[model samples]
Each structure stands twice: as C-alpha cells, then as structure tokens.
Target: MKLKKIFLITVAVLSVFYTIGCWDMVDIDKRFFVGNIGVDRAEDGEQMLVTFTFPIVRKIAGGQGGGQGGGGGSTIVVISTVTDSIHAAARQAAMRLSRRLFFEHTRVILIGEELARDGIEEVVNFLERNTEINRRGRVIVVRGKAKDALTIKNEIEVLLALYIANIFENRDICARFIETDVDEFMKQVHSMNGNVLLPRLTPGKTDVKIGGAAVIKKYKLVGWLEENETLGANFVLGEISGADIMIDIPGYKYPVVFTVTHNKAAMELLEAGDYPKFRVKLEVKGEIVETPEQIQLAPEMLKIIEKMLEDRINHMVLASIRKLQEEYQVDLLGFGEYLSKYKPDVWEEYKKDWENIFPDAEINVETKVKIRGIGASK
Candidate 1:
C-alpha cells in the first residue's frame, strides 16, 4: 500500500509540465505567409522603402472559389512602408495588417536598380540574420522598381514569387542568366574582391522577363551586360551546360543550328610577371540540330560546320573578356582567382593594384569544336 501511494505521486507530478500549454502558440489563421520581399529607395531620398508580398491563402488554395467577381480582389497583397531599416519597415507594415507577417516561405528577393547601385550591405545583413528565410531564396535586381516586379500579374503561377523562382530551373538550358541565390551571392561578396554578376529582372506589359545580368563591383551595381555578353561570361566561367550556336552555311541560303553537347575550358599562365600573359583554350562538342533539306551530312561538311562553330565561340567568349578588360575594368572572369590559387606569389604581388593591372594583362583565346553527329542522319 505504501509503494502504490509513491507511484501515484510520481505520475501526478509529470502531468503538470504537459498541462502548462505553449507560451509561444499563435492561431494559424492569424498569420500571413510572405512569398516575396522587394527593397527600393524611397522617393524622399532619405529612407528605404520595403515591400512585402503575401498570398491570400483562401483564394490561392485549390478547391476554393474566390476571384474578382466573387467580391474578392487579386490573390496576392503587396504592402510597402518607408523606414530607416528593414526591421523597422516590417514593424511599420504590421500596423495596418490584421495578421502577423511571417517570412518562412519567402522565395524571391527583388532589389531596385537604384538601391542596388547604392549598395546592398544592409540587405545582405538582414538576409543573413533572418533565421526564417531560406538560403536558397533567389536574389534579383529589377531594371526599374522592384515593387513593380513584385506587383506583376502572373498567369502561369498564382504567386509572382513562385513564377520568378521557377524561371531559374532553366539555367542549364539557356546559360544566358546567372542563377544567383542568397548563399551564392554571399559567397561571391566574400571573395577576394566583392565583384559578382546577378540576373536582371524587367517587368513588361504582360509578363516579367528574366535575362542579362547586373555587374556588381565592390558590392555596388556598376553596369549591365546584354544576353550575349552574359552567355560569353558563362563560357569563361565554365557554367554553360547547354546552349545553341547558329552557323550561316555558304550558298545554303539558310542557317544551321548546333546544340552544345560538351564543353571544357583550360587556362594557361604562360608568363607570370608584371602584366602577365594568359591563354584560354575552350573545347566544345556539338550536334547539328537544324539543317537545310538539300544539305548533305558528309565529313567535309561537318568539318566546315566545326570550324564555323569554333570561330563563333571564340568571338563570343573574347567579346566578354574585352568588355571586362576595357569598359568595366572589373575581373569577373576568375583571372584573379586563378592566380591566387595557382601562383600565390604573383597574386600577392599584384593583389593591391589588380584593378589597374588586369586591364593591361595579355589574354589570348582559342576555341576548338567537334561535330559529334547530325540529328536523324550520318
């Protein structure tokens, strides 16, 4: 009887902890899930403007009958507030919102060109410190206002953030745009020099186009690169997985398309001294994707196609390098990184004045292409 009384007391004591209830519990219906965040400079020119986009769960959720005709508005709500900091802006936005703002589902982060040109230190810090945000969240610089990109009416994906995020899945297929997420951007920012390229977003009449790339030097946007230049940059970076080259056949009155099947790049530091000389060799293998009806799939014809592809690839890659060497005077081609790893002595000697020295560096490019096969033919 004495032992039974002690056992009953132990069970009664453990029940109290579970019965206390959750101190941090909030009702699910009282929270909003943020899908995208946009940062821009305020018109007043003294404060930062932050926009938060969240979907109306009931309207977006499948099997729910909600639309403009049903006395409802757009499926997403965008709210903007001007403040000195991101946290402050969030707090200000919460004032008029009936539900608490949550950011665990944020997929895209858009920065206005104006704000990107200024600098993204504070924005980077906020992303780093926010535990709720995923590191895979994409980062883009809008050509104009980031808020406008967030406000776009996307028919493909109900949420604009998801639509923008889905575009990155084609990185391998195009290679014309760099896939930069929060983690990748941060890694580049912490490199030997904070020089990187981020994809540019432009809003159109009926859709948003994601192409090109914004050149960032020392964490500030300096300029932009066109789609061809971006593709050339990708070639030098060895980031090209799949892309096409058009070859104009002589006397065929039509162009033949070559789809890249394999690619490799090699860099040789021929002479390491004041104003070093480097040679880049790019090798590519492709298959004829499109050809004229009368064209014969002969070895000689294939050889001609290969030669043409070589010249075109060489021109494309060299143009990007020259632009970096002459116009931007920035090194996004990993020349500095190559020297730092392979020849630390040279990097140490020129690291201080690399900005000035890179332009003077002699670079030579050589391209070789092989035609592997002709589609549905020899």
Candidate 2:
C-alpha cells in the first residue's frame, strides 16, 4: 500500500511538470519554416548578406499530395538583408516574419559567386560556430545570387527547398563527381591542404536548371568541372560509384551508353625525394544500358567497347588530374593527405611548396573498364 501511494505521487508530480513546463511550448502559427540559407558579403564593411527561404506550408497536403508530381506545389519566399552577423540577421528576419524563423530543417546553403571568389573562410567560420548547423547539409556555389536560386520553385518536388535538396542526389547526372556534404567540405577546410569541392547550380530563366561540381582551392574558388570533365574528376579521385559513359565501338556506326555499377581505385605511392608521383589503378565493371550503334553482339564488339570505355575513362581521369595538377593549383583530391600518411617526412618538406608542386607533380592514371552486355536486349 505504501509503495503504491509513492508511485502514484511521483506520477502525479511528473505529469504536472510535463503539462505546465516548456514541453511543446512553441506555437506553430508563430513559426517561419527555413528551408535554405544563402550567405554573401554586403556592400557595407563588416557586414553580411544572409538570405532565408520560407516555404508556403499551406500548399502542401497529405496522401495524394506527395506523389511524384505532387510535392513541388508550394511556393518559396526569399528574404535578404545586410547585418553585422548571421545571428543578427536571423534576429532581424524573425522580427519581420510572422513567426520565429526555425532552421533545424535547412536542406542546403548556397554561397554566391561573388562571395566564393572573395574566399569562403569567413562565411564557413560563421557556420562552424553555430551549434544548430552540422556538416551533413549539402553546400553549393551559385554562379549568380545565392538568394535568387532559393527563390526558384519550378522543379518537381513536394517542397521548393526539397527540390533543391534533391539536386544533390543526382548520381545519374554527375556520377563521376563526389556529391560533397557540409561535413566533408568542413573536413577539407580544416585540413592544412584546403582542398574542397561543391556542386554549382545554374538556374534558368524558364524552368531549366543545370548543376555541376565546382572545385574550390583552400579559401578561393578556382574553376568547375562540366559534363565529361566532371566524370574525369571522379575517375582520378577514385570517387566513382555509379557512372555511365557513351563510347563508339569499332565496327559500329553509333555509340553505346554503359553504366558503371561498381568501381575501385588503388593508389601506389612511389619512393621519396621524387616529385610525389603516385599510380592510380582504376577497375570499373558495368552493364550496357543503351547502344544506338550496334555491330551485332559478337566477341569483337564486346572487346572493342571494353577498350573504348577504358580509354575514355583513362582520358577523363588524366584530364581531371592534369587540370587539378596544372590549372586550379588546388589539391581538392586529398592527394596531400595520402602522401602525408605514407610519406610523412616528404610531406613536411613538400608542404611548403605544395601550391607550387601541385601543378608539376606527376600523376599516372591507369584504368580498366569491363563492359558487360546490354542487358537481355540491345
């Protein structure tokens, strides 16, 4: 009887605390949904332009509302202003908005081209210090206004913010390039090497949209990888997961498209004191998806396709390596990290002239792609 009475007393006290305390205190009507954030430098000194994307939640429905063509029905509201800091801007937006702005669900953060060209260190510092933000969020570079990109709502998604988020999952679109996450970019920035990459989204006047991976050197925006160049970037870095390539097989007038389902890259570090040369051995295996040019499915056709695929992959990989090594002068591939672990003393010396040596360093790319049949049919 005494134990029962004590249990009842505890339950009663806990229930009262839960009901009266801060539990579920935030009012839904007083909340502004934050789907994306865009950061750039303002015209004023010691200021920043922060843009937030707000979704019109009323347009969204349940059940039939979430079908493939359903979700992208809502509209997006973009607010941009200059503030002393990000938090200050957040506070200002909150005051102007009907409800407090909530950011726990932000899908992406965009950095404008102007800001990227100016060096992303200060902006990155702000993101890192904020306790609410993490690295899983995808980061992208906008050739134009980052805020304007968030305002775009033409894509087919349940939400405008989600539509932009889906752009990051485009493996078929940019299979070769690694879809960089916020955390991954931070890891690169934290490293002394400062090699990072982000997807660049170019929104169109109509409903058209184009996205490709952009390479960023330690603090500065260097260049970009388009179409096949993006594929080569993947091959050289060994970040290939699932990519498709079109090659012209011998004896066949048209080209065939093959999808690489699995691939692995093996790196071999050479002896020290040399210009840090490394061998990249690429192994790719995939089945054919389409072939407009068919010369009959003979052993010769298969062999030719295999050889062509290997050559193209190798070419693209080498091109990416050459561009990174010769043009951008950024070690976004983490080659320096590989060298440091395998050859520490060498990295210590090479560290000083890394920017100088990056272009001159010799990178040998050897690739082998096995082209399987075009499924059951051609």
Which candidate wins on lDDT? 1
lDDT of 2 by residue, 1-378 (tens): 999999999999999988877675677666777788898767663467899887766555342465543545446678888886677888988777777787777778888777787788876786788777655777888877786676664647656667777765767545744577777777777885456877777766534244556777777788887757777777656666677788875566777888887788877776455477777889988888778633456677788778888888888888877877777877766678777887787889888888887677778878887865568764
Tens-place lDDT digits, model 1, residues 1-378:
999999998888767655765565567788888888999999997688999999888776642543433345688899999998887887899998999888878899998999988997788888888887889999898999998888776677777788899998988777788788999888887884568888999988658988888988887889998888898888778777788888887778779998887778888788977898999888887788899778878988788888888889889988989998898999988898899998898889889999999998999888889888788965
Model 2: lowest-lDDT 10 consecutive positions: 61-70
Q: Candidate 1 — which residues are off by over 4 angstroms?
A: 1-23, 62-71
TM-score of every prediction relative to native: 0.91, 0.86
Q: Which stretches of candidate 2 lie over 4 Å from their true place?
A: 1-24, 43-46, 62-74, 206-210, 250-253
Instruction: Enumerate residue pairs that collide in model 2.
Output: 71-157, 71-158, 72-157, 72-158, 135-183, 325-359
